[model samples]
Target: MKLVVGLGNPDREYRDTYHNIGFNAVDILAARLDAPAFAYDKKSNAELADVALGGKVLLCKPQTYMNLSGDSVGYLSRYYKIDMRDIIVLYDDIDIAKGVVRARLDGSAGTHNGMRDIVSKLGGTGFARVRIGTGFKPNYMSLADYVLSHFSSGERDLLKAACEAACDFTEKWIKGEDWQELTVTVAR
Candidate 1:
């Protein structure tokens, strides 16, 4: 089974924040795939849903908030016996400009605290990941505050379009299409 985890803070207040782009992408993917509704899984502290896509695909959104995301991902990885290679993590990247999406089969966690925690718990960087661009933080604001800030209406539209592209990218990846060959950016 392949596991897909989206990293984000779990709370209504954080739902529309730039940092929640990962959660947004998974939600769009679930709808596009006609996947069943996600249910809270206490064991993993995540919301999960299963869908058939050539094989079983487990979609996950950790409920442990961003910094502690590893708590949920690590537990689920062990419980499901999912290899790091079969796991795909989606999260926001402030380093990329908005409307850009990037994917890698394996990589370092970089500046994302959530990814850092996940990498620490998993003990390796061998996993697929898709990063949604949230754009760089303004120099006047702190990183934490900027990430948690809500997007403007214009930015929201751009992000939604980017999320749709990410879902398409993810679908192709699951169906054995080469990820590098897929388009990774949405026209702005």
Candidate 2:
């Protein structure tokens, strides 16, 4: 089984925020695969769905919230007996340019608190991460406010494209393609 987690705050208020890019990507993936509706699972503290692809069961989770994401991820990971290598995390990256996607096999959380919490609970950064760039916010706005803010009209179109690209790269990654090749293909 492969576990694909999208990190985001789960609330109506966070629906279209920059921090919810992960959720956006997962939605695209689910739509592409015609996956079933996501229902909230109390035990996992996430909206969960399941689908089969490439002979492996794919478990999707849009965690409860960014700060408490590890709770759901750890729960699902343990329940499914999935190894770190079979896990993929998708989230927004402020450092990269908008409309771009980056994939990494394993790495520190960098500046993302959600990733940090996941690493802490999982005991390591041995899983894969797909980062969809949201672009940097202006210095005038606090990081919290910036991340929770909605994307501008112009940014929305770019974000939509980026989300689709992220989903495509995710499918490739799950299929055991080279990380570099996936990145290069999405970067094009």
**lDDT score, residue 45, model 2?**
83
The C-alpha RMSD of each candidate to the native structure, in angstroms, is 1.2, 2.0
- Which digits, one per residue and each the tens of the lDDT, describe model 1 over residues 20-54? 99999999999988999999999999999999999
Clashing pairs in 1: none
> What are the per-residue Cα lDDT tens digits for candidate 2 across 1-188?
88888888888889889999999899899998888999888888888888888856465564557987888888888887889989999999898778878888898899999999899888899999999988898899999999999987867878888899888878887788876534522332
Off by over 4 Å in 1: 180-183
Supply candidate 1's per-residue lDDT for 17: 92
lDDT for 63 (candidate 2): 54
Candidate 2 colliding pairs = none
Task: Choose the strongest candidate by TM-score.
Answer: 1
Task: Kindly state the number of residue pairs that clash in model 2.
Answer: 0
The per-model lDDT (C-alpha) reads: 0.89, 0.84
